[model samples]
Target chain A: MSLDLFLNQVVPVRQKLFRFAYRLLGNEEDAQDITQDALMKVWSQQEKMPELQNMEAWCMRITRNLALDKIKSRKYRLADELDRAGEVPAAQHNPHAMAEKNDVMGKVRQMIHELPEKYRTLIQLRDMDGYSYQEIADILELDMNDVKVNLHRARKAVREKLQNIQVYGL
Target chain B: MDYNQIIAILDRYWEGETSLEEEALLRRFFSEPHPDMPEPLQEAVPLFGYFQEEIANEAALPDMPEIPVVATSSARVVRLSPFRHWMKYAAVLLMAIGMGYAMKQYQQREVKASLAEIQQQKLEAETRMAYLETKKALELLAKNLNKGTTQMQKLSYFNDATGIITGTN
Candidate 1:
């Protein structure tokens, strides 16, 4: 029964878990390792399955913790911006337009990345991953109100930066 | 969609009051090009555009490696012989023998020490006995010598009397 539940429910979310870890660690290999470790952890703690209401959030929480621990243990720096400069596939036809678009997107990425880890994680989890505030709260082990307030602050900070960029073209 | 509605949603989004649906709607709205984009919407375009691109890129990530199945019920339990850890048993036995030898040696030393103490105590008692006997013998000799002195004193008295009688004066 436990194995079946694991294969059905927990195994299917490895991609999401990997993406979440990747966003946190900013490295594919580390993200993959963290994902596998999270799965193994979930599998090992199968006795808690019956009591859990949201297994996916628990799995994500585990992945986030592992990734954060890795970041903390090694004082890990995210991959260099130049390393990911070509990551976003360009859709523009003109060379100049593509370069400009890439440049703008890179700035946006950098802006988000410059936010504190908590704020960056909140933005990515809510805006990019489309997780509900409650799900995010569960994953982050925070109160729902705290999640909303922090997310509001994070978005506000980003908007201020965005306004600056729009006005100064910086 | 009306520009006003987009602006309202964007405001709510900035305040973090927008639901997931509204956020998704905003993402969809920004994904398309607006020929005459409003001033307010321009600031959010890049941000939403980045989110859309990030989502796309994440979606394009390859599937994770296959997970191995963990068997729960069919776990095999192998029976073990009693001497699986013979070295540990040997170690324990050796330790016990060593402790026993040490205790025996300690007890033997204690017995020998007590015997020597007893012998020493006996010698001390015998010496004390000899000293007391010698003391008693010397006391008797002293008493006899004192009696002889008194008799000699009496004889000297008698001799003086004889000398007086013999002088006749």
Candidate 2:
């Protein structure tokens, strides 16, 4: 493929790629770096872009793999973000913001974070980024039905946990 | 949207039945709650809000960096064929056996040299002892012979004197 076509097809997905990484890894710096890394990979393989089926999804997959590797390297757990809820009052004096420590969304974030990786990733791709089901399947290399099933289970798991957070104010 | 309609849509949403469009509608409905929005669905407002806040908090993506075109691995990867792998092991085995043989030969040579040195020392010591023993035996023989010779000479003289005297008698 010509450099212009590679530039056109690969460059525009930067924001979406960043968003995907940022959602997966709640760290913006790491997300930006992952986006760059993924893009660089795509650019390196520019000759193959013409035959590539879905450039955006392919790039997203690369970003997803790279982000997951980063997460694993750091031994970072999304589960730990919620675990830090107890430690939130170290310096913040705003009582309202401090109360955000125990907010439902915080619990939801943790619940989503605690999800099995495939479920969490599919949920993030579908619910947070609003990728179409097919796009998610393409990126994740899962069939559409499996994607739907996993997304359903992911949402249900979060909702079930949120039910607990509501009942006992976890 | 009627409260019943929203409730119905949320039911479908939880069951994973809502289309992307329907889900988008739910997000819009919860984006800013109407004053009379159903109390039950109020909890969903933050969930949708969380998604919004999460995606919106994107760091400004910087422009692509200049990726230097590094050489690919295919150019560098040394794929050893099965035959080559066997050849490698065979070469290693041959080297090891050759080294072992060379070492054994060196050791044998060292043993032979030490044994020869030991035999030479032993032979020199035995030769020196035999020479000393022979000298001691010859000295004893010479001493005894000298005493016999003296006795014989004396006898010879006495016989001569007796022959002369007996002839006159």
Candidate 3:
């Protein structure tokens, strides 16, 4: 395919790619930086990329690699400081109608953040980005069965955490 | 309440048995407001809601910076000729072998030159030692001949004196 056509197709998926990076890295600046870096890589190899079957998945794979590199380089602590800081105010408020939604959302984010990096990454791609199992497997370089298994386990873990929260009144 | 069916599906899900359609069905089922649902499945409602919300949020991510365009050439798509690839590899291999052979030849020449130099020095030292020994032997022979000549002259003087005394008597 021509360069213009490739860019036209890939540029629109940039946002979703950035979002995946953001979730993986947990920082907006790093996400943006990784997204740009991935785009540059794809641009450099545009000649070899058009032959690829799933361009979006390929681009996302690049983005995921870049984000993981950033995480490994800077050693981001997985304490979910962003979620915790945002949660403090909601935690202080009572279970008011509007606050309850925020609390639930906060708890969900915390649960996701608490998941292992492997499971969290697959979950972000499969559930958040809406990628198919095959696409997730390709992007993550895992077996299709592994993707399905991890996605299931990740969702189940979240479900279990929510159940425990309700039972223990957290 | 059909909580047993939901539980069974959840168990199957963790085992990686659920299809994409089945997963979507679970997501939808959990999303509904079922007041009569079991306590565990009830708690799962908020979690599923969070998943959907997060997905929507990801889809709504802001635009990223535009990537710079690169020039594309159609000629690049043509597969490299097999013969050309083979030639390239052969050239690389030949160059590597040639370099190794050149290095070996250089080392051998260095060793040969050094050996020749050592042999030449040993020959020159042997010639100088032979010349010094010959000069010492010639000096010893000359000293011995001078001593013999002196002894013969003294004996002739003695003989002449004895003959004169016998004639007078």
Return the TM-scores of chain A for each candidate in numbered order.
0.94, 0.81, 0.84
Candidate 2 regions off by >4 Å? A77-102, B59-169
**Cα lDDT computed for each candidate against the true fold:** 0.90, 0.78, 0.76
- Evaluated with DockQ, which candidate comes out highest? 1
Candidate 3, residues A1-170, lDDT tens digits: the string is 55565667789888887888888876677789888898888888888775888888889889988888877888875436555464343344456765777777777777777889888887666555557888888888889888877787877787678777787856
Name the candidate, 2 or 3, with the larger DockQ value.
3
Model 2, C-alpha of B99: deviation from truth (Å): 44
Interface RMSD of 3: 2.4
Misplaced by over 4 Å in model 1 are A88-92, B70-169
Q: Worst 10-residue stretch by lDDT in candidate 3 chain A?
A: A84-93
lDDT of 3 by residue, B43-154 (tens): 6677678787776665565667666666665565667677877978899999999999999999999999999999999999999999999999999999998999899888
Docking class of 2: acceptable
Per-residue C-alpha lDDT of model 2 across residues B80-113, encoded as one tens digit per residue: 6778578788999999999999999999999999
* lDDT tens per residue, model 1, B1-85: 7999999999999999999999889988999999899898998988988998888888887889987665556669999888998
Q: Model 3 chain B, poorest ten-residue lDDT window?
A: B67-76
lDDT for position B127 in model 2: 100
